[model samples]
Target chain A: MDSIRLNQLIEENYQKIFLLALKMLKNYEDAEDATQDIFLKVYENIKSFRKEAKFTTWIYRIALNHIYYMNNKRNKEISRFPEAHEMRTEMNANPSSVLHEKELFVSLENVINLLSPRQKEVFVMRYYNQLPFKKIAQILGKSLGTVKSNYFFAMQKIKNDLQNQNLLEFQE
Target chain B: MKCIDKNILLDYLNDVLSSRKKKHIASHLSECGHCRRELEKWKKILDITQEFVDQDVKLNPVPPHAHITQRFSKLPQNDESSFWVRYWVKPAIATASLIFIALMVFFFAPKTVPELTENYYVIDNVTYTETISLEDRYLDNLETLYLQEIYENEELTYDILYGDWQNYEEVLNDLDHDELEELINKMYDNEIT
Candidate 1:
C-alpha cells in the first residue's frame, strides 16, 4: 500500500468503478483490466484533484473518461453490450421465477441502451454506482439542477419504455 | 399525504431525499396505498438495478492486486530526505551559485576613480612633493643634459658677452677671496676643456 489513506480510498471505490466500467464496456475481462488501469491513473494524478469537487466525483470523472476511450477503441455503441442472444436462449429455457427476473433484467438492459448518452450516464451513475445527484453534477461539471433534471428525464424514459413493453403498468 | 409525485417517489427510492423528506414520504407511504404502490414500483426498479451491479461484482473476479503492491516498493516514498532534496537542497545550490557570481563581480570589476599619490614641486625655493610620472622624469633628464652642454660653452657666448653681468659681478665682489679664486680656476678649466 502506498499509504493507509490511499489504500482506504482504493478499497472504498474499487467495486463501484469496476461495476461502472463493466456496464459501459460490456466486456468482463476488458472492464476488469480497465478498472486496474483507472486506479493506477488515479494514483499517478491524485495530486491534481482539486478540493472544489469531492474525491468521489473526481474518481468518477476519470473512470468515465477511461471507459469512453476504451469504447472508442473497440468501436462500440451503447447498444452493443454483452450478447443478448445468448442470454435470451438461456432465459427461454427457464419459464418460472427465472423468467420474471430475466424480464426485468432484460427490460432494464434494453431501456438502458435506448437512452440518450447523457441520460444513460446520469442513469448509470445514479443507479448502478448509487452516487448522489450532487456528486454527479460535480463530476459532469454541470449544475446540480441540470443533473437532477437529466436523471428525471432518464427515469421517465425508462418507466415509459417499461410500460410500453408491459414490464410496468402506467399511463402513456 | 396526497398521491406522491412519481419523481419524488423515485428520489425516495434512490435515497437521494433528505432524512426529513424521507420520514415524511415514509409516513405517507404507510398511510396511502396508491403512493405505496408507486414507491414499490421505483423500489423494484432500484432493487433490480442493485442486484445487477452486485451480481456483476460477485461473478467477475477482481484482478490480482499483486502488481500494485510490487510496484509500490520500487516507487519513491515521501520521506524527509526526499522533501529536503526537493524543497531546500536544490534552492541552496542555486543561491550559492548566485552569491558566487555577485562576489566575483564585486572583486574583479574595473576601477573608475584614479588613485591619489604624493607629488613633489618647488615653491619659494622650498621643496613640495607630488607623484611624478615617467614623462616628467624623462623631461627632467633632457633639461639637465641641455643645461650641461650650455654650461660648457658659456665662455664668451654672445649672451654672456653682451649680457648684463654687472649685478652678478657686484654679487661676486662680496664673495670671499678664496671662493673668488676657486671660481676663476673652474671657469679657466671649463674654457680649456
Candidate 2:
C-alpha cells in the first residue's frame, strides 16, 4: 500500500489499537510507542496481507505480537502494573469520585495482572477493544470456540476476583 | 426454572446471545434468584471492564496521523532485514541448531574404549629378527654418487643396495683418488667417461 492509504489506516485504527496496547501494556507512553511501532509494521507489510483475513485481523496480529514482545522485554523493568497513567489523572476533583476511580482502577489492575496471559488477551480484546470473538479468533488464529471459552473464562475469573475483593457487591 | 450458567449470562450481557436464547435466559433469571444474582455479578464484571477500557482510552489518546506518517517517512526502509525475518530467520536458526546437535552427538557418542595392550608389545631379547637399519649421513658422497648414477641411468643392474652395508662412506673415504676414480668408472662405465 502507498503511504497515503497507510496513513489513513493508521489514523482510523491508531486510537483503538493504542487502547488495546495500553490495556495490554498498562503504560500510556509505552502504549503509544507500541501503537506507532505496530503501525509501522503494518505499513511495512501491508502489501503482503493478502486479504485472506480482514485488515484489522492482520493489523491486530502484528500489534499483539509486538506488544507481547515488549511485555517480555520490559518484564524485568516493570514489576507492578503501571500506575503512572493513573497517577497523572487530576486529583483535584471530588474526593469521593477520586476514591471510586482509584478503587476501580486497582480492581481492574488486579483482575488484569492476575489473569493468565491467554485469558488476559481475550479479556482485553473482547471487552477493552470491544472486538467480536470471531475477529479475535481470526487475529489469534484460534477456533471460535476457543476464543469464546477464553472470553468466558476471563470474565468468570474477573467476576470471581472482584467478589473476592468485594469490589462487586449485589443489592439486597 | 433451572439456573443458567454465568458464562451464558455474560454473553447475554454483551448482547451476543440470540434473541431466542436471550428470552430463555431472561425467563430463567426471572424465576431463579440464584441466576439473577449470577447475572448481577456478570453485570458488575462488565461494568468494571468497561471502566478499565474507558479509563485507559482516556489516558492514551492516539497520536496525530500526519505526525505518524511523517515518522514513517523518516524511518529507514530496512526492507532487507524485514525480508530476512519473514523468510530466513527460522530456517537459519533451525539449520544452525541441527548442525550444533549433530556435532554434539558426534563428539559425545560412546564407542569401544581403546584397549590398553594394543600398542604394548613384549621385548623378545631371545627370538628376534635382526632390525638392522641401513643408516647413513643424508648427503654422504658415496650415497650421492650412487643415487646420481641411478638417476642418470634408468637401466642399472646394480642399484639401491638394501643389505646392512655399514660404514660404506668410510670405505669410500679409505680409497685413494685413483681407486675412487676407478670405482666411479666401474659403477658407471659409459656415463662417467
Candidate 3:
C-alpha cells in the first residue's frame, strides 16, 4: 500500500481502533500508544493482507491481537508490583453507597474490567464496536456459537454485578 | 414455542437475529411472560451498557494528532529482495545446518531404536500415549502467553511479519524453545536498557 492509502486507512480507523484499545486497556495513555502501534503494524504488514478479507476485519484482528498482548503484559507488570496493585484493588473495592449515574458508569466499567478475557473481548466487540457476532468470530477465529456464548456469559456477569450494586433492580 | 435461550434473547435485543427467527422469537416472547421478563432483563443490561459506552466515548474524544500518519510515512517501504533474504535465506541456512548435524550424528554414532514402553500404557488393550514431554508442556505454556511476549519485546517483529495476525496462535506454537528464549531475553534486555 502506498503512503496515501495507508494514511487514508489510518484516518478512517483511528477513532474506532482507539476506542477499542481504550475500552480493552482501560487506560488513556496506553490506548493512545496502542492505537499508534496498531496502525504501524498495519502499515508494516499491508503487503501481506489478502484481497479476499475485508480491510476492517483484518485491521480489527490486528488491533485485537495487539490489545490482548498489551493487556497481558500490563497484568503481569501489575502482579510484579503488589503494593500498587493492592491500592488500586482497594479503590475499586469500595463501591459507592448511592447509585448515581456517574457511580453507575464507574460500576459498569469495573464490571467490564472484571470479566474474563474471552468474555470481555466478545462483549466489547459486540456492545462497543457494534461488530456482528459473525465478524467477531472471524476476527477471533472462533465459531459463532463460541462468540455468542462468550457474549452471553459477559452479559450475565454484568447483570449480576449491576444488580449486586443496586444499580439495577433485581428481577425474579 | 419454548422459553427463549439467553443467547437468543441477547441476539434479539441486539437485532442480529434473522428476520424469520426474530419474528418467531417476538411471537414467542409475546405469548410467554417468562420469556418476556427474560428479554426485559437483557434489554436493561444492553441499554445500560450502551449508555455507559456512549458517555465514555463522549468523555474521551480522540484528540487531534497528525503524527500517526507522519510515522506511517516514515516507515521504510517494503523491499522484496530483503524480505526473501530475511524470511527465506536465513531459515534455509538454519535448516541446512541442522540437517548436516543430524547426518553427522547418524554416521558417527551407534544408533539403536530406544524402547518407548515407559511413554505408553495399555488401556483396554489399546496403547495410549502418555502425556506430552516436559519440554512440550513448557512450550505449550509459552505459546499460551506468546501474545504477551510479542508486545513486551520488540524483537519479535520478525515473528509478526512471518505470521498472519489471524493465525498467531499456530505461528507462536511453531516457535522452538531457542527462539522463544531469545525473544524473552531481548524483552528483559530492552526493559533494563
Going through the candidates in order, their DockQ values are: 0.14, 0.22, 0.22
Model 2's CAPRI class?
Answer: incorrect
Please tell me how candidate 3 rates in CAPRI terms. Answer: incorrect
lDDT of 3 by residue, B85-141 (tens): 989998999999999999999899987766575543332314543343335566566
Worst 10 residues of 2 chain A by lDDT: A89-98
Candidate 1 collision pairs: B118-B130, B118-B131, B119-B129, B119-B130, B119-B131, B120-B129, B120-B130, B121-B128
The B-chain TM-score of model 1 reads 0.37
Better of 1 and 3 by DockQ: 3
Give a tens-digit lDDT track for model 3, residues A60-111.
Answer: 9899989989988989989899799777756644222123358788888888
lDDT of each: 0.70, 0.71, 0.78
Ranking by TM-score: 3, 2, 1
lDDT (tens digit, per residue) of candidate 2 on B149-192? 67787555233443334467779879999998888888786754
Task: List the lowest-lDDT window of 10 residues for candidate 2 chain B.
Answer: B130-139
Question: Which ranges in model 3 have alpha carbons more than 4 Å from their true place?
Answer: A1-5, A50-52, A83-101, A170-172, B71-193
What is residue B55's positional error in candidate 3, in angstroms?
0.5
- The alpha-carbon root-mean-square deviation between model 1 and the true structure, to one decimal in Å, is 19.9
